[model samples]
Target: MSRLDDIIELIQTTNEVYFITAPGRVRTAYILVDDIIELSLKVFLQEKVYEQRVNCQIDLESASLVTSRNHKDSLRRYFEEKLNIDELSNELGRGTTGVPILQNHLVSFPLIRHWSANDPNARHTFDRVIDDVKPFFALPTTAPVGTPPNPATNLLDEALIRHKTRNKFYHDQNLSGLDINDEKCLSALCAMFDLVDHLFPTFSDEVKSKHTVRCQIGVLRLKQTASLGHRELSQPYEAALQLLKKGHKYDFERRSVEHSLVHTVSDRFFGSLREQFKNTIAKLQVRINKIDTMARPKQDHIDEKNDKEKLIQILQKQLDQINALLGAP
Candidate 1:
């Protein structure tokens, strides 16, 4: 099997991996760190047993994947800010109340949906909704210096934005559409994933041990919840351009060194114009041999002299051109 396939198989043995997919062929994979999974599992099993022992007040729909209730407020706001009610309502065949209520219940659930609110004013407050969902957004506030944010995180966040923006674009009749498959965008995401994998080896190690399934299924789930778009991938492209510029500068410097050697031979080593002129004469003699070999009978001394003179003139012109090309400091 391929490396990724092997990883997928290994992750299947553990419950920490999942894949997600969405519109525009968007795909994402995620793996819960082993420690985090262990912690969450302990809480999950305890809670699961408690529900079985008691007449639970909470409906199955209200169950959330996040073990902690502290993230609830942030999650609520994220859905509000992200959903375009009018368009989402149209797509989901549900009224405005359906969206917020479902979002509330999804605290433990990871369902992707076209959410909306009953109040027209609340529905119109797109920015407010975004503010609410900021907690759910995946932009990292801290990373090691010189390191970009996690690739999976970046992709997940962009997917969220595009997911939210898609309804707005459609409602506003905007022509712009999401482009998830953009080459640069994909490259940036791939790089980010690679970086994340490098720093946190657990993801790959788990897969190698067959303790993780296709954790990519989680990203696929997220994608179905979100959307993708075609705009620029931003920082990655700029970084690449900067690298190219540095390479160009190095090449120019190397060529300048070669030009200096040519100048050393013609101007410095030859010293006086008389000696340089004699060297040119010697070069002319070598070229004359080739010309005479091509002739029916070797040309007379006059012909040879004329060829030598012409060669000297040509060399003088080339030297001038080279000097011009390598302008004075």
Candidate 2:
């Protein structure tokens, strides 16, 4: 499995672990959830760093108007932005969460050769790192009323705060009095579950691949069955939705009244529709071309044209139905 697949599996396992009945499961689940949030955040940071490096190189190679000063300022944002990091022309660093023991994995590539060394005098350092435990904390000023907030765009900062609680489980002086309980544990698990769901990546997310988008939609539906409270028997409308989310993956799976509406198979339904439409349209086009090439009376030609147009219009409506079912986006 790819890294994204591994992380997604971690999220799935974390959710299952929350339901374990062991006495220490609460504390164990909390620690595991925190790890999920932190790992996702750090992975996101690494991806962003690599993407920025690639974009900068492309701009430079294409001889775009982007200047070195702009690149330098962009690098500075990494250091100033916590999970974002940089202290030199040759080094990209991350550990802004202030975890005491960290393993810094090094990547060697020509595009990011700036990280090869750091300048002693120009380095930036923080004696202490601090941040608010601010996930799902939002107060909007300009957004329309009733607009929902995006709780955790990047959870590196929030994970750091939650880490403090996790640390108390092991390292705190309050050996007997550490405030770990069902309520707090449940609340944190719910939050962490939500974060892990957000961090799951959809492959082929370029908006240009239909098969992958449908696959992603299927994956999301299965993931959300628990959160949407449809883990058991789904409501009628939700059952329909679940069917839609299942898409091509579960087409061959046995259907039950709990999740499926139809027992009939739509075997190769979309591909068949496309093939049928293409052949009909091709035949119609050939007839129209032949009529246009022939010398006929103007009145006769007009009548034939109108008849052909109506046929084409009817075929077009059928094609529209196909397009609507197989949406472009």
Candidate 3:
């Protein structure tokens, strides 16, 4: 299974354990949920770092960091060698080789900071990431007026609180006095859903159906939309419209959804319509040519000319419609 699927399975197992009638399981559930969130974030951060490295033309294999085992080293080499950001690289470089970084480094807040500093694509991806979490941290004005205030201001706040609670449980080794409870465990599970949704929106359906715990968190509904195919199509359509408005040349190398939609629409719908129009226009032109070649009565020639002129007008109107759909001014 993929790493994402593994994390999702862990999340599902945690939810099952949280709801089962068992003593001393609430703390375990919380830790499990927190671990899933951290793991999901680590996977997401590694992907972003790798993508940026590839964009910068850094050779992952040549740097001896092609495999997932050496992704942290790859990230360090990329930032230090490619971008020349020695400070960030050195900061990320402190951990021993092959050892996982701390929770803070893998989570959204710190990873987003590093990405935003170095990559332009980070802002767009971060905006989407923030959107996934907004429902969790929504305010009355920002959300519906009757809704409850968002519990945390941002993802960092949520991560910090959960991490602190987890550390207390692990380091202190005393759950009796700790504040971990069913409600807190549920909140952490919800946060895990948000993080996973941000990283892999397409997996939302699988996560929702497989998770056993039922919660009243508002973010669940938002995650459901990610599974919608029509919603996915709208993204490409809107992008295509924006590109059309800007009058920019299409980048064939990118092969974006917009690019595919343009070609699909042209070939399947507009291309066929254009061919039909061309046939009609060609037929009219042939009749006009024949009328000119043959010695017909002046009145007969005038009537044929008028008929050809009417067909030309009709053809022009159809052509205009086609051009309008093609985004011609």
Candidate 4:
């Protein structure tokens, strides 16, 4: 039996299940398995020895709760390699929000008072959960008592293929830049948020992630991809012509480009914009120091001459850099 079939069979043996769905570039459907079989599988998969120093920091305020220090790195791998979101979604009869929510839950657990830090015993517990269900990944098929066995299929892989098709439609069709209906453009905006939200529950708090703020700002200046078979597409249509040719790929492309560009610029400018501010402040500090020296009761007029020249030169250079950065675009 396929992994998906195993999951479905396991669920069928259970009493009830809860589900969550998320839609975006890809959809993730999650089925909540609160059974012994499900819990055991989780522990087993989590037990694999990670070759890195794992940080089990419970409090975010004390210090940064850095998790993937020596681990496989990346939340994406956690979903695909560990939980297998797509298969889980199919088992639950939901869309795609399943994987992200589980990731969020794992990361959101409170500091367990009895949890041992860096203890192998504690770590083994997680492993055991996954080990119990390792067979789910490779269960043998019984073929329903010989009706003719069907080939196994990984639902997650199928979902990924579907997601790619939708992605091309949304991004490659590139009709975003034109003066089109606000509703479609608005939907794109919502879709962007929804995509991130579905894929990563830690999406907004992505600010806390490595270089996330910079990356998010970078997303503003993206480009659009023209729809397929629109080589003859042109601009400035007549009012009547405009009404007829409503769904051009150019409109989608334009919106995508504009949104991406906005994000790119925001990330580039804001990420290190403070450094520029500090440079300006340093220049001002030189002048302030000179002024303080000049106002002193024992002001050395001889030293003031050198100080004045240095301050003037520093301020001029600072102002020049500021002007250049601002005027660039």
Candidates' lDDT values, in order? Answer: 0.36, 0.45, 0.50, 0.33
Q: Give candidate 4 regions above 4 Å deviation.
A: 1-205, 210-262, 265-267, 296-329
Q: Candidate 3, 227: how far from true, in Å? A: 27
Q: Can you rank all candidates by TM-score, best first?
A: 2, 3, 1, 4
What's model 4's lDDT at 262?
27
The stretch of ten residues in a row with the least summed lDDT in candidate 1 is 211-220
Clashes of 2: 6
- Total clashes for model 1: 41
Using lDDT as the measure, which candidate wins?
3
lDDT of 2 at 248: 38
- Candidate number with greatest TM-score: 2
lDDT rank order: 3, 2, 1, 4
The whole-model C-alpha lDDT of candidate 4 against the native structure comes to 0.33
> What are the models' TM-scores?
0.20, 0.39, 0.37, 0.18
* Backbone atom clashes (below 3 Å) for every candidate: 41, 6, 0, 58
Tell me the deviation in Å of residue 325 in model 4: 22
lDDT of 4 by residue, 95-168 (tens): 47755643454454322211232232544342343333334344457545555322112322332333343345
